[model samples]
Target: MAGAAELFVWWVLAVVLQVFLTGPLSWLEWTVAAGAAVPAAFGARAVRRASGAGSGGGARALHAVLVWPVALVADTGRLASLTLRALRGRQVRGRFQTLELGRGTGAAWACTLLSATPGAYAVGLGRGRFVLVHTLPGPPGVLADALTDGRRS
Candidate 1:
């Protein structure tokens, strides 16, 4: 099932790219696209299986698409501001701290989302489901607060 999903996604992307880069897709172009997509899709499926992430790849992908863009833009703005401040010779102190993320899949999801935010990275999981993260100089709770704040809404 995952392989089929990956194959479909890649083929769609290839067709779009081919059309944009060249022109309307010819039968030859489509055959070439399918040939290329097959191996890539299988490779992706293999990796996904190895990762042991829960099923429903399509849902996870959809959730990411819905939530990521706004979060990314906000994080980018914050990171740029911090960078400008540092360039002005202001002293900055970054630190590592552990945040209490509840157990199970939600914790895993939160850790991944926090890691993707700018100016922060989840180093690893800590004792009791805590997520150890490093962040640019700011309140120790900044990232944690951001994560929880999003949850409330």
Candidate 2:
């Protein structure tokens, strides 16, 4: 019953996302979206259950979505600046920094999300929920700063 509920929820989310991405759809498009949603929903449900990530992820997921584009754009600009600075004979340093991580799903999601941006690459999840990330010299992007604050702040 719980799995069924979760699957249904995932299906709805998949359909909604399809609509959001594609805009208004004709009957054929709706049929295609509904068909594609089943596999997408099952994949989401499987990943969630297999990973054993508990509920209460909605806010985190929403936060990640909001953070992603900003991080991408900010990091892109930062990278361009670094390139120009380096071309002008300024030193560009890349450093590895350790950030504290919360136990459970937050660490994985945070690392994955942070690494998706251009300026930071999470090296590993280390001792006591610490993650090592290598970042280009500059101000950390929004995602990295939020992640460095350790799941709250």
- Top model by lDDT, which number? 2
Give me the displacement of residue 43 in model 1, in angstroms: 6.3
Model 1 score (lDDT): 0.58
* Top-TM-score candidate index: 2
Error of 1 at 96 (Å): 1.4
For 33-149, candidate 2 gives per-residue lDDT tens digits of 899999987887777667554533456556766888888888999999999999999999888888765333356456667887788898876665577889878666778655555
**CA RMSD, predictions in order:** 6.6, 4.8
lDDT of 2 at 41: 79
Give lDDT tens digits, candidate 1, residues 1-153.
755765576556555556656777779987886687667656645554675543333444445435655666766787788788889998766778666642233444455566766756888765554667787665533445544433210
Least accurate stretch of 10 residues (summed lDDT) in model 1?
144-153
> Once superposed on the true structure, which residue ranges of model 1 sit more than 4 Å away at CA?
1-65, 106-109, 139-153
What C-alpha lDDT values do all the predictions have? 0.58, 0.73
**Clash count in backbone of candidate 2:** 0
